[model samples]
Target: MSLSKDKGEQNPLEKALAAYIEALQTKPVLTKAVTSGCISAIGSLVSQLIVPNPANGGKIVWRSVAAYAAFGFVVSGPLIHKFYILLDKMMPPKKEKTALDGIKRVVVDRLVFAPPFLLLFLYVITILEGQGHQAAIARIRESFFPVLKLNLQVWTVFQYVNVNYVPPKYRVLFGNALALIWSVFVASKRRKMALANK
Candidate 1:
């Protein structure tokens, strides 16, 4: 039996845990910026189908991607990082592991990180709809609630994956894939509904 631990000696396990924690502490700001940009790009591609009637002419994919990437890089990175730090301070976790301890992380991200994002996304939709006509805007509003519901549901799940499995560095890539899926689903369904109504 190792009596060193008995004497409150910090063994290899304690050392490793401490080191792992310190590594996590060194989060780079750039990582968040990159991640947000990538996800926005994914969303843009998905949104492409919805605008221009995919007819009159315009490159929705590139435009949406550029718009979202800028929003993420310029706006989201700083805001989200600050938001997380604030949550950690206000809702200091008993442990950073999982559960309410974990719940805290998810709640903070969802409650704080999501509202502005949703607003931004809605704004994007508005701009896209506006490009067409008043009728287009009405169509979007009609489809908005259902599409938004799906987007939220998917995002909730993705955020969990992002918070838990993702290191800060790779979070952007993972989130991008998820966002793409959500956008595709929403755009596709909205189109389907529109055609059926026609």
Candidate 2:
């Protein structure tokens, strides 16, 4: 009886996972957008916690969080989803996947996709935060290369695993999972730069 009960019972995590999978199938873009937005907001919140803002007496900046969330939902999620599709289309997977195929995808992702995307992120976030174009350019000048260096170092290994192992449908979700940490770093860096400029 206990064994049967245990088998029938589903934990919240399991139920949520099931729902997410279903949503992905039914509404791929929306699901990814919402998921990415939530993760981005969480990352921003975590950043605020870790590097409390002296400007606001360490209180959580809900506006900043909203900006991050909006960027994820409106930009990152859809763009990433399409980008992965493009990558796969460019280098269609083989019946027998090879190391070379994965390497090519990663190279293109890091070189072609990442740099422009990072610049866009900086620019968009600044705009979303109500900072003007000049601020965006300044932010880019200050952080672009350093952030790109770190991004390549970290995402190269992760992208290899993602492109090689993860299914095309789930690739954006997998990348978003990893992007949680990246988001935190970006949020923190953005905040730090803003403060420094002031």
Candidate 3:
């Protein structure tokens, strides 16, 4: 009876994993987008748990988490998925993924995508946190360059491997996996700043 109960409890999770894999196979783009959202949401939750709000007597900020999840779902997911497609179309990878091709991708991505995307991300998050247009603009001014500099420092090395080694279809998934850690860092910093301002 106990053995049966254990199996029953495990079945749902196993089934869900199987279903997710099937979706990845059948609908790669949508699956990757949804996967990005889910991963970002989880990352947000982890950040919130790690950082407490003294304003609310150390309570978790569900609003920030929800906003992070929504941002992932609405902006990061689909936008990133499409961006990868565009990157491939724009650069047209060589017959064999080579070191030079990887370098070219890294250069283009950092130059073209990173700046605008980072600005958009900061703007959206600022707006989502109920700050107005001016605040959003201000946040961008204050934060964008520093964040972009750090982004280059971290992501350049990773993107070489990501672009060169990972297949096109799987690139977004790989990026989202890596961005999971980045999301945690971003969410925690944003939350702390938000709390401090209050």
Candidate 4:
């Protein structure tokens, strides 16, 4: 009788446990994570493409598309997601998430965020350049302030657009577009710099 009664009663938590199990099986959390990842990568490549154009002399077009794509997928995508996720968690939007909240985001992002990403980006470019002869640092060192000013302008402007208008949901796509522009400039500059050096 007790055994039958126990079966009839069951447990409320059993339903919850079952629901949780079902949720895991479907893995919506994982899907969301992946979506975030894709967004980040795509966005970054686009942004990277644009900001490097100051180096371009004449040849600036769609030639750097592949590089921008790869950059987006590999470097920019993963890093952007990490930044966005961390920032979201550390300082999640309480209400509607005002733009003024950018102050906190900027503090965590630029100080803790921008430098590392920028360093890694520079490092990657440096390595790629070194592999051939386009070493980014060497080229930049060949002309310091000009490169500095050019980079400052592009990054600052691009970032402002990204932070102000773009919702975090779309930052990745935004970044990709910006990267594409940077790539054009970068490719053009690289070509010109190479030719001039010769």
TM-score per candidate: 0.57, 0.86, 0.80, 0.49
For candidate 2, the 10 contiguous residues with the lowest summed lDDT are 1-10
The best candidate in terms of TM-score: 2
lDDT of 2 by residue, 67-147 (tens): 999999999999998998898889887878778887888899989999999999999999898888999999999999998
Candidate 2: stretches off by over 4 Å: 1-9, 183-198
Runs in model 4 deviating more than 4 A are: 1-68, 94-100, 129-154, 157-161, 182-198
Winning candidate number (lDDT): 2
lDDT of each: 0.62, 0.86, 0.79, 0.55
Span of ten consecutive residues with least summed lDDT in model 3: 1-10
Any residue pairs clashing in model 1, and if so which? 35-172, 98-102, 99-103
Better of 3 and 4 by lDDT: 3
Query: What TM-score should be assigned to candidate 3?
Result: 0.80
Cα lDDT tens digits, model 1, 1-198, are 243354356777776655444543565456567667777766776567563454547456565567677777766665666655565577564534766556667766777667656665556544643454565456556665675566567677677666655665445546656666767776788778878987
Candidate RMSDs in order: 9.8, 4.3, 5.5, 12.8
Candidate 4 lDDT score at position 192: 71
Backbone collision count in every prediction?
3, 0, 0, 34
Error of 2 at 128 (Å): 0.5
Candidate order by lDDT, decreasing, is 2, 3, 1, 4
Q: Write the per-residue lDDT of candidate 3 for residues 42-140, one digit (tens) a residue.
A: 887787676665578877777766777778878887887788888889888788767777789889888888899899989998888788899999999
